[model samples]
Target: MIHPLDKAPEQGEAGLLKRLLRAGLPVAPTVAVALEEEFLRLANLQEQIGLLFQGVFGARIDEERLFYAAERAESLVRESYLLPERAEAFLGSLKGWQGPFLVRDSGRSPFAQARTPQEALFALKRLYASRYRVEEVLERWPRLFPTLDLVLVQEAGAPQEDPGLSLKAAELLGQPARVEAWEGRVVRVILD
Candidate 1:
């Protein structure tokens, strides 16, 4: 879903295709619009895939897991235009949460993964500035084509939180169910 930098503005629908001309420079088309497009892209993907996933799996998937799988998981990968460009690594959600998060921005190249307040500030800026879920265009990010490569929102590293909420006890359906994880975070489900 990648388009050349020169032509990105024209095809505004495909935000994933748009690339920042210079990684060091401020994000093109202003930071606000970029943010809108980013969230719109995410929300749209959620809309398209969420329905299908719920239909097949018959279980609700969290926004974090859906976005992560859309970006990284092999089983969830699909050649859909609703997806982000490979040029941009999928950073997980950045909204409705608190601090102590490690934002990964592997835009063009990799750099020191500073777990300092600097990265957190950058994410906060994106969170506050970008206008993604608005009734608008083009999105916000706080995750623009700036120096950021990946935008992380959940537990850093591969590990995720598992409170061991039993499906049998919660659902109370007496149906067999299983929860699976990748590197500790729950990623898959099996129900019978």
Candidate 2:
């Protein structure tokens, strides 16, 4: 059973029909009542259709997958509310992480000028196992960049440990950062 807050009177029911009537539907109120009943039936059918999906997919669906899918669906629904009018400055704040920067270096602190963004990001994920947990990091990153577009985080280029940039990250993550660079090669990051 769904909590009352999670339930609606089967959308397009009596209340909806009454609302339509009040909003100037010429149909009789009895028609509204019929529509409401029909809508409830449709909702029941929809629920059955969802059950059918679960039955067909059940053999392949594990509890973890179901939980993750449900969580993702809920998040999508909730995130839809974060539009420009509602989110304002609070939107970009998601990008700020309380943890350390997940740097993606190519094992060389100096840029090879050959490493692609994809390669760099992959390397970063490999270097920092804890930070690359995409879903969790993403939740925080939205505060920095509000779009649900994952590319914003995916395209953050490669972060290298440079004196200046390290200082920036240190200030941002609020920790003393030990700058590591390949000897004789300066650490450089292309800031987008």
Candidate lDDT scores, in order, read 0.30, 0.29
Across 1-192, the per-residue lDDT of candidate 2 in tens digits comes to 111111213332223323333444321112101121232243353243234224223335354544454344333322222223322322222223222222322222322221343343333223322221335334553331122211111122233355754455345434554332233122222322
lDDT of 1 by residue, 1-192 (tens): 222233334322112212212212121121111332454355454354344334221245355543443333222222322234422322223233333333322221111222433464345334422212221111332232222222322223332323352242224324453432234333222343
Candidate 1 contains a number of clashing pairs equal to 15
Poorest 10 consecutive residues by lDDT, candidate 1: 24-33
Candidate 2 Cα deviation (angstroms), residue 169 = 9.5
List candidate 2 segments past 4 Å from native.
1-79, 90-157, 163-176, 179-192
**What are the clash counts of all predictions, listed in order?**
15, 13
Off by over 4 Å in 1: 1-114, 132-155, 158-192
Q: RMSDs, each prediction?
A: 19.9, 22.6
